[model samples]
Target chain A: MTARIGVVTFPGSLDDRDTQRAIRLAGAEPVALWHKDKDLHQVDAVVLPGGFSYGDYLRAGAISRFSPVMETVIEQAKAGLPVLGICNGFQILTEAHLLPGGMLGNDHLHFICRDQKLRVENADTAWTVDYASGQEIHIPLKNMDGRYVADEYTLDKLEAEGRVVFRYLDFNPNGSLRDIAGITNEAGNVVGLMPHPEHATEPLIGTGRTDGLPFFTSILKKLVNA
Target chain B: MARVVVDVMLKPEILDPQGQAVQRALPRLGFDGISDVRQGKRFELEVEGPVDEAALARIHDLAESFLANTVIEDFTVKIEEVAEAVK
Candidate 1:
């Protein structure tokens, strides 16, 4: 049976369709989830796509963290539901308190959009089981508030727990702490990253490199085997 | 009336390429004397009423928990009787 995954669409969300396409390309059913809809549509996992939700008012992801669907996402994530937050979605995860730390403005105080290089730090998460730890991959990263920050205690905890999933391999674009490109919760189900993996899943549209397909495929395999 | 100021930033462990890029541009902008510039944002909030000490504490909670990222950014809170400052 093909696995079903849900991609949420929030107002101002720009990457929902791309995420859906990635899910479909990975041989999984892509279900469209609305921000106001509380049900997850019986999907195996959820991807909160990147965007400027709620026009990024008050702070990035601050207002949208209270959306109806996030309440359910938060509860289910705590119970070990697999969730991936990309870029602004990562912002929402932090805002919802599902993940540690927060995202701030780029250190240069300007919008940054580019193809970013990253190294896979931990490959054991629900969404990253397909990649080898320490592997290098390049993906597109575009956002204004993309800096990742946390307290020293929290950083130590994340590092000590092996929850730091991705790190900047060649260059640091947004000045994230410890060069952390992404991280997972203690349960290993919730993964949040600042890069746009969904944008790198297709061969023709991108550099013909599917460097990010593993994220979708890994979760589908987890569901198939579960 | 009282106000709170929160400044959040990224940690020093990571390289701030953007900040460095801007620092490099400062000399070319005819501001050759200026150097070493770093950038971040500031948020100032006005409290609703006679905010008790507990309410002020709540604001700090908001700062550390969600308002400010403690890892990359260091935040300082200043709770001054703005009514006196204004007068």
Candidate 2:
């Protein structure tokens, strides 16, 4: 059976189509979900693509965290649903408390856009099972508010629990705590990251390489096995 | 009616990049005496009708959960003014 992956589109979403395409490329059916719709349509998994949701008003992803659909997403995510939040979506996850930490303005006060390299710190998550531990992959990163911050205790807990799923490599693009690019919840089902893996999933577009194909394939494989 | 004002600021431990940029630029602009600049958000809410202690508590909760992210920020709420007792 082909897995059905849902991609949510908020008002300012820019990469929902790309994420759905990536899901299709991984042999899964892509379901278009609306920000106002609470029903997920029984999708095997969900992906929140990056964009300036709610115009990044008040704060990036701040207002969108309270969207009607997010109410269901948060509940399902807590119930061990496989959810991937990319960039702005990651901001929403944090704002909704589905994940730890909050994002702030880049340390240099500039919007950074680059092909970022990340090391797979913990490949045991529902979204990263295909990547080998400590393996490095390049993905595009673009955003203004991408610096992740958290309390010291929370940071230590994330590190101790091995929940830091991805860490920046070579150079820390933003001043994220401990160079963290992505992280997973305790159940390893919900993952949030500040990079655009969907943009790099296609060989023709991923800077001429398919480094981010593993993310989509990994989730599809998990759905198939379960 | 009552006016509620909530102020949210990044925790001291967390880095404030925007605030830091302003601080650094201030020196370049010949304002070197200032130090430790930080930026934050302020929300002013106007509640309808007379706000009692219960309403105050609820507003506090709203500020904590929505107006501020407790993970890396702190918030303070003040009921600025209460409605005059009407006859």
Candidate 3:
């Protein structure tokens, strides 16, 4: 049986379709989940795609975190459900407190769009199992509020616990502290990152590299094996 | 009717690039001697009925949980008295 991965579409979501396509490319069934719907339809995993939900009002992901769907997403995610949040999705995760810290405006105070290099620092997470630790890959990064910040204590704890899953390589885009590009929860079932892996899943498109396809395949393999 | 105000500001330790940009432009505009500038948001809510201690406490909770992200910001709540119209 094929694994079913759900992609949530909140108001103003721009990448839900692209994320669904990426899931399909990874050999998993893509389920479209709405923000108002409380049911997850028993999907094996969930992906919060990038986009300005609720017009980015009251903060990038603030209002969306209180949405009805997130009520369920948060509860299920805590129970060990695998969840991946990309870009704005990452913002939502942090706002929901499923992940720590918060995203602020880029230090440069500008929207940046580029093919960014990243190193996989931890590969044991539910969303990153297919990648080898220390592997370097390029994925597209774009956002205005992409700078990641947290208290010194939380930063130290995340580092000590191996929760920092990905780091910027060569150049640190958006000025995330310690060059953190991604992180996972303690259980490793929840992961959030600023880069758009869905955009890099096809070799013929975008940067002509399929480096981000593994994120989808990784979760699919994990769910099927379970 | 009563008016309640909530002021949200980023923590002093966090960087405020937008505020800095405004500060940088001030010297060029002949507005000098300003040592620093910090940007923040102000929200005014209109509520019906008296804003007793219980209502004020509720607003405090709202400011803490939804009006501002405590991780990066601080907020204060104030009650603004509405002046009666001239007869």
- Candidate 3 residues A128-155, lDDT tens each? 9999998999999999889999989999
lDDT of 1 by residue, A1-226 (tens): 8998999999989999999999998999999999999999788899999999999986788877889999889988998889999998999998888899878777666788877888999999999999999899988888898878887889999999999999987778877778988989999999999999888998776646789899999999999999
Query: Candidate 2, residues A33-107: lDDT per residue as tens digits?
Result: 999999999998999999999999988898999999999999999998899999999999999988999998888
Candidate 1 i-RMS = 4.7
TM-score of each: 0.79, 0.95, 0.98
Restricting to chain A, the TM-score for each candidate equals 0.98, 0.98, 0.99
Summing lDDT over every window of 10 consecutive residues in candidate 2 chain B, give the lowest-scoring window: B76-85
DockQ (CA atoms), all models = 0.29, 0.74, 0.87
Candidate with maximal TM-score = 3
Residue-level lDDT for A140 in candidate 2: 93
Model 2, which residues run further than 4 Å from truth? B29-32, B81-87
Instruction: Give candidate 3 misplaced runs (Cα > 4 Å).
Output: B84-87
RMSD of 3: 1.1
Model number with the top lDDT: 3
| Candidate 2, number of clashes | 1
Enumerate the chain B TM-scores of all models: 0.71, 0.84, 0.93
